[model samples]
Target: MDTTRSLVYIAFCAAVIAVLAQVMIPLPLVPITGQTLAIGLVVTLLGKKYGTQAVCLYIMLGAIGLPVFTAFSGGLGVLVGPTGGYIIGFIPTAMIIGLYFEKFGYTYVHAVIANIIGMFVTLLFGALWLKLFANLTWSAAFISGVLPFMIAGIVKACIAATVGLTLKRRLQQAKLLQIIQ
Candidate 1:
């Protein structure tokens, strides 16, 4: 892609992440958010490099105090606070899922698998950060950080994969796939 189109894709995906972060559930420790689904969608659509850049841009916006984080909150404080790891976790999540599509192929099955694995990595980082920042024990961290999100993660991954593949196929058919990976 050209420089303009690449930048546009990054900016657009970053905006999508911001928009998705608004759908928060306001839980006690970590709010249930649409971020994972958004990451899955962006990675499946943009591939590794562009997708990672988009996520990084999203983080940079949040780091600079943009209200792009969950619960419409942002800033360095939010990024380093109790739930910040999940926010930071998007980087690797995008990389993992996007890498799968680029390395293997952009199939529905691959998307689903990649998304699931990415979700797990996010959970791992989230739980670890929760343990450290919240001063919770490992079990407690697992309970609060991972347990509640398990089912939702699977559902979100499936939704992202299904939608991603459908949209990808449509784009390919329309010859607009050249703009993407």
Candidate 2:
């Protein structure tokens, strides 16, 4: 892919993920959405450098009051909100996923493990932030912020992993991976 085309593609994926954030199924804690799955897919398809850049761009857009976050709310408040940890967690989550993809060839099993790990890392960061900034007890935080999302996260991870593996195979077969590289 040409530089311009690649950048455009990255921006498009970022926007799609941002839009997916709004399509939420409200849960006891944070609402569940397809954003994480999208993130995993983007990283797997785009590789580490561009994948991380795409997620960073998404974060920057959301932080700047672009309404790219869930419910079309953004700005500094969103970063400090109850779900802020998860929002902010996307940064390292993307980085970790990208790194994993680059370091290990994409296998369905490995992709599943990688996506699960990435989601767990996001949850860990989000939970910690909730405890520190929201003044929630560990038990309360876990109950309200992490536990409720566990099953959903697992499902999302599995779906993302499967999709990512499939896409990787297609890209390799089509020689699109070489163009992207």
lDDT per residue for candidate 1 within 1-181, as digits (tens), equals 7899889888998999899989877778898899999999888888889989999999999999999988778899997898888988889889988878888888778888999998998999899999999899999999999999999999999999998788767877887667678
RMSD to the hidden true structure, all candidates: 1.2, 1.7
> Each candidate: what lDDT?
0.88, 0.82
Q: Return the TM-score for each candidate structure.
A: 0.95, 0.91
How do the residues 1-181 of candidate 2 rate in per-residue lDDT, one tens digit apiece? 6788788868977987798788789876578877787888777777777777888898899889999988888898988988889878888998898777767867788788888988998889888988998899998888887888888888988988887777767877987666552
Worst 10-residue lDDT window, candidate 1? 171-180
TM-score of the candidate numbered 1? 0.95
The true-structure Cα RMSD of candidate 1 reads: 1.2
Clashes of each: 0, 1
How far out, in Å, is residue 106 in model 2? Answer: 0.5
**How does model 2 score by TM-score?**
0.91
